[model samples]
Target: MTEGRKLRPEERILWGKVAKSTRALRARQDEVAEYEAEITAMLAAEEAALARPAPPQDVVSPPGNQLRAPRPAPSHQPLEKPVHRKLAKGRLSIEARIDLHGLFQDEAHDLLLDFLFRAHERGMRHVLVITGKGSSMGSEGVLRRTVPLWFSKPEFRFLISSYEWAARHHGGEGALYVRLSRPRRSL
Candidate 1:
C-alpha cells in the first residue's frame, strides 16, 4: 500500500496464483463472438430435430356408418356485405348489444362470451359489442384491440358466425356487429 513498495511474501504468492490461474483474452474475438456460438448451437439442434422422423401411430376404423355432428363454422369470419349493408342502412335490426366501456380485458372477455352464448340460445341473429375506440391518449384501448382477436379463440368459434365494424352512427370503429350461429332444434 506504500509508494513504490514491493508486496509482502504471502501477497506475492497470492498474486502469482491469480496471474497463473487467469488466461489472456482475445479482446476482439470476445467482443464479436458474444451469443454467436450459442445461437449457432441452438439452430443446429433445431435442424437435427427436424431431420428426425415422427413415430408411427395405430389407426382404428369405425364399426359401422353413424351420424356425426356438423362441423363448426370457420373462426373469425367477416360480416357479409349484404348483411353489413342492411345493418348500416337500418334494414336489419341489432337484437341485442353489450357495451364494454371502462372494463378490463378479462371482464370484457367473460361478459362478451356470456352475452353471445345467451343471445345464441335465444335465437338472436345479430348483436353489437361496443369497445370504445380508446381514450383520447392517442393509443387504442386494450379492449378495442383485443376483442376482435378473441373471436378467433376456440370458445368463440361456435358462438360467432360473422362480425364487422358498425356504422358511424352506431359507434363506427368503436363498435362491432356480430352475427350469431343458430342453435339446432332436436326432433
Candidate 2:
C-alpha cells in the first residue's frame, strides 16, 4: 500500500515497538505516583511523631532518700545580726561624699564599692553617702534609692559595719551615715 494508506510488515513492527514504549511509560508513571504517595505518608507520620507532647514529670527531686511533702512555705526571716562586721564605740573624723546623679547603675555600684573599700582601708569610721535626695522627674532619682539596696547585698554588707541616716546638721536625707569597721589596730 501507499505511505498513508496501510502499514507494511516492517512498518507494523515499528508501530508495535511504539505501543510497547507507551505502555512502559504508563507503568513507570504509575510506579512514580505510588512512590510519591508512600513518601508523603512517611512525612506525615514523622510530623505526627514530632507533634506528640512530652510526658509531664517533675525534673527536680528531694535530697537523698528523703521524700519531700508539700507544705506551706516558711515566713521570710529578716537577718537581725550584723553580717561579717562589728562597730566600735568611737567614730573616725574622716568624711567622703560622692554625687551620684548621672551615674549608670553598674558604674555607680563599682564606684560605691571602691569608695567603701578604700575608706575602710584608710581607717574611716563615719562616712557621708550623698545620693541626691531624688529627681523632680518623679522616677525616684538615679542612685538615690538604689544605694541602700546595694548595702544590703551579701558582698557589700560586710564592708559596712553599721549605718544610719545622717544627722540634720549634715546633708540629712540626701546622705547616709555609714559607720565602717575599725582596723584591728584601732580596735
Candidate 3:
C-alpha cells in the first residue's frame, strides 16, 4: 500500500476491510486497557489495606492514672425489686402519660427515656406508656414488645421500679403502668 496512491476497485475494497478490522481491534485494545487499569487500582487498594498495622488490644489510660479492667456488659434482665408486691387495686395513679402510637422505634425509645428521666427528677411515682395493640399484619405490634425490653435495660432499670399492665379504664393490654423510683439525693 503506497501513501497518497489511488487504488484499483478490488484493492480499495480489500483496504477498506483492513481499515475496518484495525479500528475494531483498536477499540478492543482500549476496552482491555480500561479493564486492566481498574484491576490495578483494586490490587493497589487491597495491598494498602493489608500493609496497615492491626489496632492495639489493650486500652491505655492517660498519664497519672492507672488502667482499670474493662467493666462487664450490663445484663439484659431488669433489676430485681426490693419489694415484689403488686400495687394494691386503686392505690397507684398515673401522674404522667406518653403515647408511643405511630412513632418509629428510635423516636419512641428516645421519648420514653426522656419522659422517664424527667418524671423521675420530678419525683413522679406512676406513669402510663401507651403502645397501641400492633397491626393485624404478620409483623404485629413492634412497640408493644420493644417498650418492655427497653425498660429492662440497665439505664432504665435504676429509674423504673416496676411496670405492669394498666387497668382496663387506663389502657388495658395496650398500656403499662410504670412505677418510678424516688429521686436519688446527690452527695
Candidate 4:
C-alpha cells in the first residue's frame, strides 16, 4: 500500500479510479443491506399479524334460524330539532334533486348512490329524491319501499344526516328530503 508518496500521473489516475470504485461498491452494499433489513422487518410483522387471532364479530340468529352478520351501529348523531323543523317546513331549500320515476330497481339504486355521493362531495346539505307515488303499479311503491332500506345501508348511511318524507308542496309521500353530512376537509 502507498503512503503519502507522490506517484506518476498514470499511477495517480489509476489509484483515484480504484478509490472511487471501492466507495461506490461500499455504498451499494449498504443500500442492499438496508433494503434487506426493511424487507425482513415487514415479513416478520406480517407473520405476527397472521398468527394473532381475529377479534370476535357479532352474529345474530334470524327468525328462520339462519345466522347473519349484525348490522353496524349508526355513525351519524341525530339532527338538531331546528334543522328538522326547517326540513319539515320546506324552508331549507333543496340543493339537488333526483327523480327515480322510470328506472328499474337496480338502475335506481345505482343512480341514487351516485347522486348522493356527488352531492355530499360538493357540500350539499338538502337534496330531494322523488320515487313517485306508485299509483298505477299497485298499493305499495317499489322505490318507496327500497329507498329507506338503501339509506340505512353502510355505504349510504355515513353520508346522510337524516331523511324524511318531503312536504306536500315538495312531493308529499312520493319524495324524500335528505340532509347530507358535511364534507370532510382533506389534509
Candidate 5:
C-alpha cells in the first residue's frame, strides 16, 4: 500500500488481471442475488393465491344442454299464428283502400292499418288504394313508390296476403289493390 513505488512490468500485468477477475465475480454475485429475489417474489405470490378462495366455474356442458333454475309458467297462453294466404292471385279474400293525398308518413301508416283491420274484420275480399298520382306534388311520385316499401316491412307484412297494381278501371298507377287474410271463425 505504498503511495509511490515503481512496479515490474510482469507484476503490473498480474495485478490488472486479478482486478478484472474480482469485478467479474462481483457482477456474477449481483446476478445471482437478482435471480433469487425474483424466485422469492414468485413464491410469495403463489402463497397468496393459495390463501384465497377460488371462484366457482361453470360446468362444462354439451351443445343444447345448460343447467338452469326452473321458471314459473307464463300467465297467459301464447298467441296462435294468424292464418294467412301464401299465394298472390285474382281477387284477395279481403281488400283495402288507402289515400295518401295530404297525409304525413305516420298518418298514412295509421290509415293503412285502420283500412286493413276494417277490411279483415268485415271479410271483404279485395280493396283498392288511391295514393293519388304523386306527380302533382312535385315529387314525381317518390312517395307513391315508397308506400309499397313501407307495406313490405315486417310489421305491416302480416296483414297483407298479396298486392298488385290496380286495374286500369280501378285507378291504375295512382292506386293499388291489396288483399288481406280473412279472420278465422273459431267454432
Candidate 6:
C-alpha cells in the first residue's frame, strides 16, 4: 500500500470535475426532522386512541348482549406489569416515601392516607410505602396487611389506582409502590 499524499493541483482540478458530475444516491436524512415526524405520529396515535370507546373494564352479568345500567368502575386494580418492571429496574421514580416501621396500624393508616392526599394535591403519581417486614418470625407485619386492605375502601379507591409489592432494592415484600389516580375532572 502507498502512503496517502496531498493531491497535486491538476489532480485536485480533475477530482473537482468528477465530484461535480456525480449526485448523491439519496437525499440527506435530517435527524431533527425524523424525530419531529416520530413525535407527530405518536400524537396522532394518541388522538385516535382517545376517540375510540374503550372496552369494558369490569365484567358484566348474564353473558349476553343485554346492556345493564353502566356501573361505577371497580375500585381496586392490579398493578400494571410494565410500570412494575420499571420500578423493579429502578427506571421509575417515586415522588415520596413514608416509613411505618414503628408506628401502630391506626397511626400508619392515617399517615398513609394523609400522605397520599397531599401527594395527589401536589400532582405526584407514584409513591413508596415502607412497611417493614413484621419480624424474624417470618409472619407479615400488621401494617403491610392492613395498608393494602385500606386501599379496598371506597375512599381509598378514589385516591389509589393500584398498589403492588416493591422490588428487592425497593425493600422487596416489605414495601409497596402505590399509583394514585388523578382527581376526576368536573364535567
Clash counts per candidate, in order, are 0, 0, 0, 0, 7, 0
Score candidate 2 by TM-score against the native. Answer: 0.46
Q: Which ten residues in a row have the lowest lDDT in candidate 1?
A: 50-59
Task: Provide the lDDT at 167 for model 5.
Answer: 52
List candidate 4 stretches off by more than 4 Å. 1-72, 75-81, 88-90
Candidate structures ordered by TM-score, highest first: 1, 6, 4, 3, 2, 5
What digit string (tens of lDDT, one per residue) describes model 2 on residues 37-131? Answer: 99779758755654564455544665786665544322223222342122122233436666665567898899889999898888876677777
lDDT of 1 by residue, 1-187 (tens): 6556556656655776777676547876775476668866975875565455445454554679655655444756688899999998889999999999767789899999999999999999999999988743334566876788788677988888889999999999999999998887899
For candidate 1, what is the lDDT?
0.80
Please list the C-alpha lDDT of all candidates, in the order they appear.
Answer: 0.80, 0.62, 0.72, 0.78, 0.60, 0.78
RMSD of candidate 2 to the truth, in angstroms, is 31.5
Query: Candidate 6's error at 19, in angstroms?
Result: 91
Alpha-carbon deviation at 152 in model 1, angstroms: 1.1
How big is the positional error of residue 157 in model 6, measured in Å on the Cα after superposition? 1.2
Across 68-90, the per-residue lDDT of candidate 3 in tens digits comes to 96754333333234321233255
Candidate 2, which segments miss by more than 4 Å at Cα? 1-94, 184-187
Q: Which candidate is the best by TM-score?
A: 1
Q: List the residue pairs that clash in candidate 5.
A: 93-125, 94-124, 94-125, 95-126, 95-127, 96-127, 97-128
CA RMSD for every model? 18.7, 31.5, 23.0, 25.2, 34.0, 22.9
Of 5 and 6, the candidate ranking higher by lDDT: 6
Candidate 1 local Cα displacement, residue 120, angstroms: 0.6
In lDDT terms, how accurate is model 6?
0.78
Q: Tens-digit lDDT track for model 6 on 1-187?
A: 9857766656755776787676544454566567779977975875566456568686567766777767664556678999999978878888899998767778888888899899888888899999987653333566776687677666677888888999988998899999988877778
| Candidate with the greatest lDDT versus the true structure | 1
Evaluate residue 66 in candidate 3 and report its C-alpha lDDT on the 0 to 100 scale: 83
